[model samples]
Target chain A: MRAAVCIALAVVAVAACACRIPEDPDGTLDRVEGGVMRVGITESDPWVELEGGVPTGGVEVRLVRRFARDLGARIEWVDGSEEELVDALKEGSLDLVIGGLTSKSRWKKDAAFTRPYVETTTVVGVPAGSSLPDDLDGVTVAAELGTEAEALVDAKTDADVRPVRDLGRAHGEPAAAHDYVLDDLGLAAGTELKEDKHVMAARLGENAFLVRLERFLLGRSEEIERMLRKEGRP
Target chain B: MTDRRETEGPFRRFELPEELLPEQRKAVRLEWLTLVYMLSAVVLLALTLGQSQAMKAAWIEDLLSLLPPAAFLIASAMRTRDPSAKFPWGFHRSVSVAYVFAALALLVMGAYVFFDSAFKLVTAERPPIGVIQLFGEEIWLGWVMIGALVYSGLPAVFLGRAKLKLADELHDKVLYADAQMNKADWMTVSAAIVGILGIGVGLWWADAVAAIFISLDILHDGWKNMRASVHDLMDARPRRHDAREFHPIVDRIEDELRKLDWIEDGAVRLREEGHVFTGEVLVVPREDDHLVDRLEELAHHLLSLEWKVYDIVVVPVREIDIPSRDGRPRSSAVGEEPARSP
Candidate 1:
């Protein structure tokens, strides 16, 4: 048994020694570092936004531009729906996709995600003079339609949840939105609801590129948070 | 070997002077050693329990591997106890009881791993493997996981080799079964490696695919052992240790019964109670003169046929209900007579 354990340990040592660092199968990191980077973008508020029919603004949009320059690569942006961009990313046509994708993104299984670069939270906030209630049970709370906060509010509280197209304009009324937007809408925070871990998508199996991108994004967490503070201003 | 006319049964018993006592001690020592090895393996496997389906399976298999040694050791300790008023048959059959429970665990755990991996495959759940830092270097977690599996799995190969040798010497089914399990460990390690490496190579489904195959293999082993042990519990004729074929001792004892000059024909039935056999023989007698003396001698003779024979009863009967060589219709098998020897 001792001899067998030793043999196995030796094999592990050899395997570990063979590659101290993990290598990407398609060499995405090497190719992108000194070449043009193809980026897929979609309109997601605060992370991505489209102005004049071109992808622009948002924290992730600006971060990707900086990431491209850091890699010494030129940037090219492609705009499409989440499904279309994800399919193209899977096909290796686009190196990265940014749409304020969260851990709860529907395309999670189909794409490789970088480590979460930033974490955002949803909270039920009320205008300053409103008395703070212990909980939202049976209390009407406005949550944005088609957002994770909407589902989180329903799951985490017995609130008389009302879905609206916009939570920003629901000032003075108790509502669930990104915590950063609470102060902008003149609402004081109350109940902390749920958190979202935001990440970027890469083609599956691009390990080195994913790690490099993760490192790049994770390094600027403070900057991402700072940029997020300016978002959704009236 | 001399057939000693000794009293030994549910009502009475005595220890046969074991010439292999030292060897038995060695076998117990070996079992304990194997147990320790598996305990360490279980720990190592637990540490590598990442999101990969294959690693999870390999961990479960190693965890299940600890059962055989435990059963064997407990049964050995119980085998030495004296019969009590509450349990006159003694603890000789404790191993058989343990076998059933061990088989049950194997079946349940194996099935769990199998279905979970298959579900992951069908649902297209990508394994969430990422990077970890080792000595200030960011190495992929897959390499560490695979390496841990190899380290955890390798010692079993050599342990299996050692157990194989001990099995031959001790003629122990438990040791042999454990050895067989160890031999298959390499296949599991290789399959898991393939799965982990597949993830590295861009085959997203490779980990799940490999997991399904590994789980199927484990489930097969579990099913086979479960069937065998359950049959043993039902007293389905004493088969060879592997439960593949009938033990030759049955035929030898029956032939010996027929060889007795006063017996016109004879039939024997035996049941395995762990390491030993207890049985009855029915004979058609041609003569009754000095029959009582002859009966004791024959019973003694049967016990000496093999070390596994713990006790035997020789009875004079009008006739033996010889089971037909051809398949008896199911209706007849359940007809008028309810109990018939297979």
Candidate 2:
């Protein structure tokens, strides 16, 4: 019995030594080429929008789909709030994140951003016929949670900023840009609040993925512009 | 008058032969590498703290682990210094002192981490891990933890393997102890990674469980090192290479002395001072004439038995004097008389 146990132990030791993972120096590129590229998205109109519980159309969706094809890989989409998506990107679960993300995202330190693909102005939206509040101090303004618009309102205005999960339920009025379609929500866009550039983010130190993404974006500028024009929004 | 004569007695200081130049050079190089790796581990661990409670524990272990290598480096450097009025035995025993100190540090760290982890397990306190937004996704904190473990573990394995061979060649207990600590580092780090990954997957108890296992392993090593070092400090009979029992060097020496034609019977006592032996023996000679010369020849022969037997004093005994009723002469009486060929 003891001899059998000794032989078993020897076999186990040999097996343990034999089975070791070879180091992949260029892990990001290897993952992108042979594994699923996880993309995180937030609900933003004209950039990433859901139609009947499926991502129907968006400039970001098309661009990412093309990039995945170029890498000979499949894409897995994860949807969450801006903070959740950014957190996923930083922790390396998601290779890329897209949702009309502004270049001024607070998570810049944690992840690298692609060059801006589009630029637009931030504006305050008031309920139709209500008129914009002047010298707005102590006014309660709602912005989509975890978005740059929320950060902008908090930093650039004395107004009491309320973060709403969905802007449609923002009741009376909220702040957003033209693409968000405040007019369709029975609200009117006020004076431009801030000029902002939109970009995608990737995990920090994933230089290969970032380089490929930047190259893809640079090559598809004309297509992106055309898509923007077709959507009838900046 | 007797104290003055003893002070001026023929106490011919013995010196072990210097190690081959190449081996000495290799040892120095190994120590430098160990010091550099230890410093880097400390810096990396400090930078990677605050990720989780497991991470904090790892950082503390790394901090405590630095003591052994640091002690080895200092002791090895000073081990060859000449004896002075302040230090009568030169600096050879520094290695043994370092071994004891390093063992103590390990024991303390092991006990502390073990209890702390057990407490955390009982409390079921979930570790709060923060996530960073990359590209547009929320990645869990597990990947960061794995990366930190890989960074710390790889260098430690390399350094540990490199030092172990050199420690053996040099017969350095302190270096050997330090090397063991470095070797076990990867196990702790890998366990921490698994724990963090488990917690990431919502297994809340895994981190503490892994920590407890790691601490137990460390405690086992610490206890072994402590026992060995304490035995050396007390001048206990040296153990064999495996350290399971007493070494056969003393027994072999006694046998050789008894086989000699001029000697009736002999007693051999050996004690380790760091990596070397310094002890005395009482030989009952068949005749008193030319007894010192015979013993000198025997002492030289015994020294050749093991290079570690650097000092041995052989006395010509008239009879088996059991003064203390233990059949063993007082070490103090035998210790004063240096081996001199008359």
DockQ of 2: 0.03
TM-score (C-alpha) between model 1 and the true structure? 0.71
**Residue A92 lDDT, candidate 2, scale 0-100:** 69
Model number with the top TM-score: 1
Model 1 lDDT per residue over B30-79, tens place: 78987898888788767766568898888888888899889889988887
The native-contact fractions of the candidates, in order shown, are 0.11, 0.00
Error of 2 at A86 (Å): 27
Could you give candidate 1's per-residue lDDT for residues A1-234 as a string of tens digits?
A: 455465456445645665523456667788899898899999988888898647668888889888999999988889998999999998789999999898788888778887788898888877778775566777898988887788888888778789999776787788887777888888887788888899899877677788778767755778788899886553
Model 1, residue A143: distance off in Å is: 3.3
Deviating ranges (above 4 Å) for candidate 2: A1-234, B1-19, B132-140, B320-342
DockQ of each: 0.12, 0.03
lDDT string for model 2 (B1-342, tens) is 000011123432333345644665776677677677667776866755533556766767777777877786787677666678999766778878888988888788889988988987796554434343357653333455566666776677777877788766765667677777778887777667666655544455767887887888778888999999999999888775337667778778877876897877567777887767777777766777775566677777777787677677777765434232235554532333444432
lDDT of 1: 0.77
